[model samples]
Structure formats: C-alpha cells, structure tokens
Target: MGFQKRPYEPTLFVKIGENGKMLIACLYVDDLIFMGNNKGMFSYFKRSMMNEFKMSDLGRIHYFLGLEVVQSNDGIFVSQKKYAREILNRFKMQHFNPTNIPVEFGLKLTKAGRGKKTDSTFYKQIVGSLMYLTSTILDIMYAISLVSGYMECPTAMHLLAAKRILRYLQETKDFRIFYEKGEKADLIGFTDCDYAEDQDSIKSTSGYVFMLGTGAVSWSSKKQTIVTLSSTEAEFVAATACAC
Candidate 1:
C-alpha cells in the first residue's frame, strides 16, 4: 500500500515458496515483517518483490516496526534506539540528563495527584509514542507497562515517571539485543515475580524473558491475573503464565 493509503488498507500479505522452502511476508502499514527458514530463498524473494514494486530495499532489515534489526554471521539483534530518540524528540526531552534506570528502584506509581497538571493531550501523545517504542525495546517493558496504567487520566506525576523512562533511554540508547547463533539453539525461559507490587491494587507483577541460544528475542512484564498470598505462589503463578 502507498503511504497515503495506509489508513485505508493497513496490512499486506504475501507468500513465497521455492524448492520446498516457504517464506511469508506480513506488511502492516509501513512495517514489513518476513519469516522463512531458508535465508537464501528469502533474499531472492525480497529482491523479486523489489523488482516488481516501488519499495525501497532497507538492506538486511536493520529497522522495522519500531524495532532495530541487526544481522550478524551468528544471528540477529533487534532493539529500538531510533524509536527511543523519536520519543525523546517528540517530548522535547532529547536534551534531558540521562539516568541509570528506567524507573526508581523503590518507587511505587499510583493514581494519586501530587505533581503539577499539564495538557492531557500532550501526556497521551507521549504515552502512545512510548507504547509504540516498546514493541521492539523489551528492556523498558516494566517501566512502560507501569506508566501505561495511568493512560485513562494521567497526572503530572505519571508524566514525570514517563519522562524518567525517556531519560533512561537516553543513557542506554546504544543498547541492542544480540541474537547470537551457536550450537545451543534451544529456547530457554526465565521468570520472576514481585508480590503486591502495585500498592493501589495489591497485585503482583510477573516478568519473563526467552532466549534463543545467546540472544533474547521475546519477553514480557505484566500484572498477574489473580492475587497470591506468598512469594512462592506468585512465582508459581508467574511460571504458569510464562508457560502459556
């Protein structure tokens, strides 16, 4: 679809098959995602598509859908450094000082009003941009998820917390996921839980990261569905959630 026609038809679907190898391309708006087992076949398909279409070859998929794609001899690394900078610049926060962490270690974000009020539209715009940035930047999942809870009617404190995340991104803008290829290609998962993390709802937050070989490609941080009485229960719940 043309850039101007994106809103009308936001997705494009294509399938390529050659010599028992199949490749699928899913294009959402301006983002294109391709998957196939055979790298050579995929490359050929991409070239063919470019020949038949007006699309510009991004060259090895370094950036797409807010994710920065890095290909190496070993594997692929994906992150969102560009998305982070876009967010910072959108909020006029590119000049802000960098921080070590996305959020304060012991800080608890609640709906209580404590900070100065600003334009709600600006706050929502920042939140939406950050949410898009998180699609490829899983490192900021926890902080983004926490701040997203206040989207309904964000307060100044919530905006500050969100800004802090931008500050954190400024410090770690160079960080990227390294998908290394090795003998150990098995999928490994890690899970952790925090009991009663949300003071307002008293709900636990669970997080998990899945690594393929030496690189992490999938992860999530979310609040648990049910309340648990103990840390063991919370951990077990988190484990079960990860299993799904």
Candidate 2:
C-alpha cells in the first residue's frame, strides 16, 4: 500500500524498499501491469487490486501495444516482428526486394521543387508506421526522423526514401532488443548530431539513446531548432538535449 506515484510519469507507481526489494507498476487506463523483486509485495498488491476492482490476471506479459516480449531464464527480449511484417504488407512492400540500409549514404533530402508530388496522406501513413517500429529497431531511427519531416508535403523522392525504410525493415524484421540479467545495472547514454544536414533550412539533427543494462529504455531523434556554426557546437547541443 506504500505505492508512490511518480511526478514525471504519473501513470507509473513505485514501492521503494530499503531492504533491497521494490515494486514497480504501470497503469494504462483499465489495464495494470506490475513487477517486483519481492514476491510478498506482488501477492499483497494482487489481493488489493482484486478486492478493489474486478480484473483478470493475464499472467506474464507476452504482447502489449504491438510490442512482443519474449522472456527467457536469463532475460527478456522485445521485438515487433509481426507489426513490421504487417506494415510491409499494408503498404504492398512485402514482396519487394529488401535493402541493405534504410537511408542511402550521402543522401541529402531537401524541400527543393525537383521531385514529383506524391500523395501526402499515403506518405504520412508510411512514415507513421515506421515511427512505431523505432521502439525496438534503433537502426532506423535516423531514417524515420528524416522521412517524418516531409510528411506535410511529401514528394516522390520522399516516398521512395520511405519505401526504402520498409524494405530495410523487411530485411531485418526479426531484430529484437534483449535485456539480460547482470551483476550490475548501469545507465548508459549516447548522443549524436548531423551538422546542417537539412539543406532547406541548414538545421542540424540531434539524436540520443539511453540504455539500462542490456536494453535501451529511452531514445529520440529530431531536427534541432537552432542552427549551430560548427560540428562541435552541434554535438554539444545534442549532448545537452540528451542530458535533459
């Protein structure tokens, strides 16, 4: 009953233990998922939840919100293989040839009036589908970030880039992020930025990823608002954003 709601993440509740035991629970609407190092706390919480409301115990989480979690004796592996395939089929790219990379090297996407105009609606859908896959497919983060910027007025070039991403996904749809058990739990973070990569506005893009133990817990890739004079400044901005 000593559950404390987190200020930043209000939907999450935690029971801190001084005796090296703790419980963490995430509440999403009517669904409740909780995990802990103490079995006693789990039983108590389950009993309390059952007494207060009518709910069924779904047991261990295998799938939730398009994310599939495969739990083994050593760790938990998270993936979106089914979702990725569905995306490919939804856009009729399932039978297309797979690519080695999501985005081509030295590819500089711009808003210049050169390529033929494509359906903005369709392009948005493609970019949106790939956006969620970034939840586990870290490799496509930069590519998704690039294509998402063109959603407002996507051209044929943008559409092709988006398709390339799906093709890349088709090639690497089985990728998963595994969180393995370890003697120590360390938080590690990485930050990167492309100096003036956007030709239209000459803006830099910043990206960051933070990993807890063997799996990434948080990440972001976005075009920076302000332009930096040098790569060093761009990197600093990216790092500062990452720290925040």
Candidate 3:
C-alpha cells in the first residue's frame, strides 16, 4: 500500500513494508507484472487488486510482449521462438538455409555498393520487423542494425543481408537467455567498437551490452558520431557511451 512510482522508470512502482518485505509492480498500458520476494505480501497485493478491479490473473508470466518464459528449478529462460518463426515466414525466408552467423565475419557494407535497388517498402517492412525481434534476440541486433542503416535506399545486397539475419533467426529460434536463480544480479556491461568500419563515411560503430546475472537486460549497436582516428580512441568513445 505504500508503493511509490519508481523515479527513473515511470511505469514501475515499489514499496517496502514494515516487515522489510519488498514488492514491485510494473504497468504497461493495460498489462501489469507483479514481482516480490515475500509470498504473503504478494498474495495480499493480488487480493487487493482483485477486490478493486475487473482483471484476470494469468497466473505466472509465461508470455509477455512476444517473449516466452519457461520456469524451472534451475531458473527462468526467456525467448521468442514463435515471434522469430512468424517474422521469418512473413518475409518469406522460412525456407532459406540457416547460417551459423548472422553476418559473415569481416563483411563490410556501404551505401555506395553497386547493386540493383530493392523495393523500398518491402525492405523497410522487413527491417522494422527484424528490429522488433531484436528485443529478445540479441544475436541479430548488430546484423539488423547494419542492414537497417540502408533502409532509406536499400539495395539488392542489403535485402539479401537482412534475409540472412532472418535465416539465422530461423535456425536459432529456440535460443533462450537463462536467468539462473540465486545468481548475482549485479549489473555488468561490455563495450567495443570498430575503427572506421562504415565504408561510406569512414565512421566507427560503437556497441554495448548490459547484463543482469547471465542474461542481457539492455544492449545497443550504433554508429559513432565523430570520426575516430585510432582504434584506441574508438574504444574510448565506446566505453564512454556505455558508462552513460
């Protein structure tokens, strides 16, 4: 009952009771997720909600926003197998051969690549869908973001690359991020960058991934704003960005 809205995350609310039990609730549109370490408090909170609102208790969170959660004695595993399959089929890449890697190593793409222009509308649709899929599928984040750079004027080569990501998704659709119970939830992050990887502008790309326990909670792959003269400088830029 003493729950207050979280300062940083707007939709999250938290409360600490006299017994030192902690409870949290996250609201997104009409959906709500409740989490707490105290079972008695959780039951009290659930009862209060049922008394005040017309809502259905879906039991434990198995699926949310396309993420499938599998609970076990080991811990929890989250994935998007259904969503990955849907997107692969939507883009007509379900039958394509899967690859071990989403993008070929040392592959560099540019806006000036010589190739036939692809259907802008269809290319954008595929890119957008793949971008959404990256929420639970971090392996394809870099590849998706790379191909997305050319969404404004995608070419045949760019489309092919995007489909390759879908193929990777098709192959690894069952991949899950396991959040082992009792594991330290300390936030750990890693950052790296390539010096002048973008061939067109010769600008570097910076990337970072933050994890809680063993599973990633946030990640990003973006182009650096200024030209970095050396790999050392590029790494510095990436580390600074991740620190932020």
Candidate 4:
C-alpha cells in the first residue's frame, strides 16, 4: 500500500493517495486496524490487506488488546471493565466496598514500613493487573505506580493499599475515556511534581498527561531519576520530561 512508518509512533503507518485520500493503519502483534477519510480508499485498503494476509474483520472493534471500545453518536469510549472485574475476583475482592479515591491523601509507602511480608507472587500479579488498567483508567495511574514499587518484597501495608485501589476500581468500573470525534485536533499536555515525596529516597514524584483535544493520548506517573532541592526545579524537570 506504499504506507510509510509514522515517526515517533512505531506501530502506525500512513499513506496519502494520489486522490488526496489519507489512510492510516496501526499494527499490534497480528491485529491490524484501519482508519481513513475516504470511504473508497478505506475499503480498497482493507481488501488489499485481506488478500495479503489471513485476517478476520471484527468491524468496529469492541475489544482489542484488553481494552473495550464503545462507539456512540457522540464519541468513542475505551475501558477495561471486564479486566477490572477479573482482577477483583482473582484477589477475592469482587464484592469489596467501593472507595472514592484510589490512593489516600499524604500516603507514603516506604521500604521499611512495619508490616508482615506478603506473598510476592500474588502482590506482583495484582500490580501487573493494575498496571494494565492504567492504560485506560488514567485516574489509577498514580496509585498503580506507587504500589508497583514494592513488587519485589511487598508487605501487608502495601497489599492493603493495593486492595484499596481495587476497591476504587469497583466503584468506577463503568468509567471510560471518551474520545469525541470532531475537527479539532489540538494537542495539550500537563506536568506536575511533588517535592521530596518519597520519604526513604527523598526523591520527587513526576507525572504527566497528554491530551489530544479532550481525550488523553499518553500519560505516565513515576519517581524522578534525580533528587531536586526545590519544588520549582522538580516541576521544571517534570515539564521537560513531558516535552521530550
């Protein structure tokens, strides 16, 4: 199809037809999805792909890569409700009481926290599941990242915090990230940091979320590599990371 690999996005390929029709394709392992402005060009491209490979058209994808997509008159929504429920059942928290926030305010997890050691295997599994949830559930990014730090040797306190995140998920399982379709394609990003948030390491936490108009396209929550003495410096470092 003479498509060129999209810069900065390795999985995406783009091609502009002589008729001014643009086609974009994204590949994830064996799954491929097509999007284009021209109907005729889109159909032709689909036919070409079918002839070249053994593929089935799922048509208006509802489930892909563990993310559930819902199409509506207003916009498209993505979620992971089924996965969230599975996590809850696996951890025996399916009927757990719901919580308003994923993480408690001023909560600081430490390596030297006083608690019994938890099963590393189960702790890692919970963290892994929550990490996947972060793909669509942006609100839990910070909590997931926080609990993930103790995957190697999680304690009872850490496990309790991880379960709180699950409780939060149970409360907002139906929430989805809506990507409304419109002409606007503006890209905006926000960055912030907490100075010396980590008690043990004395490292700051930096987080950023990028939005394509109203829908988030990318996001991250992690500790800074280097320690910053001032909040202004911490914020600057976070903003630089987002820009990069």
Candidate 5:
C-alpha cells in the first residue's frame, strides 16, 4: 500500500527501503506483476491485493505478454520462441529455406528497382510483424528497419529483402535472452554508424546496444534524420542519438 507510482512509467509502482528491501509492481489493464527480494513484503502485499481485488495467485511467472519466461538457479531467460514460429507460419514461411544472414553484406537498396511492383499493404504487414519480433530478436532489427522505409511503394525486390529476414528467423527462432546470475553486471554499450549508406536518402543508419551482464537491456537501430557531411559527423550524430 505504500508503493509510490513511478513518475516516468505511469503503470509502474515501487516500494523502496533503506535496508536493501524493495518491491515493484506493474499494472497492465487487469494484469499485475510484482516482484521483490523480501519475502515478508511479498506476503503482505499479496494478502492486501486479495482483500481489495479479486485476483488469482499465479505463482512464479512463466509468461508475460508475448515473452516466454524461463527461470532457473542460474538466473532468468526470456524469449519469443513461440511467437517467432507463429510469425513464420502466419506468413506461410514455416518451410521456407533458411538463410544464414538476414541481409546481404554491403548491399545497397533504393526505391528505384527493376523488379515488378508488389502489394504495398502486404509488404507493410511483413514489416510490422518483424518489428514486433525485434522485441526479443535484435539481430533482425536493422534489416526490418531497412525494409520499413519502402512501405509506400514496395517492389518485388523490397518484398524479397523483407522475406530474407523471415528465412533467417526460421533457423534462429530458438534464440533467447539469458540473464545469468553471479556475474558483475556492468552496463556496457556499443554503437556504430554507416556513412551515407542509403542510396535514395543518403542517410546513415545509427545502431547501438547496451548490455547488463549476460543480456542486452537497451538497444536501437534507426536511420538518422539529417544527412551528415562526413563519416566523422555521422558518427557524432549517431553517438548523440545513442546517448539520448
């Protein structure tokens, strides 16, 4: 009951203590998830919630939203393995031949293509689906973002490129993020940018990843807004974006 609502995250509430005791609760519509290191606090909070609201104790979390949660003595592992497979089946790519990589190395793509025009709506649907997968699949983020820019008039080549990501996913859908225990959880980050790689817009893509211990906690892959004059400028812009 003493939990304070987080200012930035409206759905999150926290109970902090000076003796290293803490509790956090998140409310998503009718769903609520709470976790803490103190058993006494957890017991008290569970009783209070049951008194005020009709709720079921689900015990340990096994799944949340579209994420699969697997816990062990080592730590926690999260992924969307089921969702990934569903994506492949939904697009009728469940049996498609797998690819080692999502995109070709150093491949330059533009709106101008000799391939026949494809269904823009279908193309956008693929992009949107892959975008959701990026929540647990960071490897495909850049490729998905690249194909997303051509949603207005996607050609056959653009569709092929988008499906290439699916083929890659077909083989790597079992990938999961593991947050192992007993490791020094240093917040490490890495960033990179390609100088004027986009042929149509001449814009550089900025990508960054921030990791905590064994798994990544923060990351992004986005196209820069401004056209930088040089590689140095592009790097500066990318670094600024990553920092912000």
Candidate 6:
C-alpha cells in the first residue's frame, strides 16, 4: 500500500453473473494473490486483463513477496534461501561459524551498559539487514524481534546477539516450507504475548501466526501501545490485536 493518504479512488472492479462464479484477487501494490475453483475462468480473466493492459506472463507463480515457490507433482514448496544467503553475504556473515539456535532461550536482553559505543553503526546495520531478511524468513522472527530492542542505542552484547541470529541463519540456510498435495487446506492460528517483556519501557510484546495447510500465510509481532492493568488485560489486548 502507498504511504500517502488521498481521497478514495477505485482502480479495479469485479462483477459476477448470477449463474457464474468469479475469482477473488487481492492486490497490495505489486504483490497479488488469486483464488478460484475453475481453471478456465482464471484463464479467461487473465486474458481479459492482458487485453486491457500490457503485461508479461511470468509462467506459473513460483516466487512472490521475496518467497520462492517450487511446484512439483507432489505439491508446492516455498523458501527464502536466496534472500537469506544474500543477507548473510551482504553483512559478511556467510563465512562465520553456524549456530544451532537463533538466540539463547530465556536470555534477557536489557538496554544498559551492555554495548560499546564504537560498534553502534555495525549493530544498526546488522539489525536492519535482519529485519529485511525476516520479511520472508519466519523462523528468524523471534530472534530479530529480540535484537530489535537495542536499536535505539546498541551495546556489544546486543551486537553479539544479532550476530548469533546471523550465524543461526548460516546453519539453516536451506530450510523451507513445503505444502504437500495430499494435505488438507485448513486455516489455524496461534497467539502469544510476553508481559512487560521490554525491560526499559515495561511494555509487553504480542505475536501471532496464522497457517494455511502446512505454510505460514500471515503473521505479526508488535509491542503494546498502552499499559495494561493486569496480566489478564494484557493477554486480552494481545488476543484482540492478533484477531484484528
């Protein structure tokens, strides 16, 4: 979506006949997702669109939104291996030793005298790269979220934590999400929150992920904007945010 705000204007429209069904196509800037039951109908729709505007057919949808998709007789597979490797090489992390985990579990990262002033730029650069990488690499979500806390004024400890995430990526560079042909098409979701997780602001962080079949289709992680009176309230708010 464009960042600028303007009056409403309709650029695309759809209509369906009473006896005929129409496919639903959702577009966000250049990214699009199309759903339809009839292959013939989709083909007709594509032809009409092509007649109206000049477009190039990229052949079957193999990649979109930084995610690489591979379709086989068995099913479809999605991965960001190329994007991950690019990030690693861009930050000069590809040659480093790989780690088993993105971050140490139960590790509390606090903003204090934990980092050195000389490495502030390096820390920011790493975090920014990781943030870009996380757009398609959901497995790195938690680690990137944790390391992002120190962006304001990073320390040596924070830099180490961010580097650990990169190292973890180095180890799991080939991982991908596979959607098999026989798997049922189902939508499921999970929500979680860490109360007062941020030591400095005492603000809780809420996260949720929604899966379709075997792949994560949507997910988010955000800090609570308002303080909650109790744990229950915090949980309720986080759930509401997740639902929305």
Off by over 4 Å in 5: none
Clashing pairs in 6: 115-155, 115-156, 116-156
lDDT of 5: 0.91
Top candidate, metric lDDT = 5
Off by over 4 Å in 4: 18-20
What local lDDT score does residue 190 receive in model 2, on the 0 to 100 scale?
92
The Cα local distance difference test for each model comes to: 0.78, 0.90, 0.88, 0.88, 0.91, 0.77
TM-score of candidate 2 to 2 decimals: 0.95
- What lDDT does candidate 2 reach at residue 7? 96
Score candidate 6 by TM-score against the native.
Answer: 0.81
Candidate 2 residue lDDT tens string, 51-83: 999999999999888899989889999999999
Model 1, runs deviating above 4 Å? 1-24, 29-59
State TM-scores per candidate. Answer: 0.79, 0.95, 0.93, 0.94, 0.95, 0.81
Please report, as a residue range, the 10-residue window in candidate 2 with the lowest summed lDDT: 106-115
Sorted by lDDT (best first), the order is 5, 2, 4, 3, 1, 6
Q: Candidate 2: count the clashes.
A: 0
lDDT of 3: 0.88
lDDT of 4: 0.88
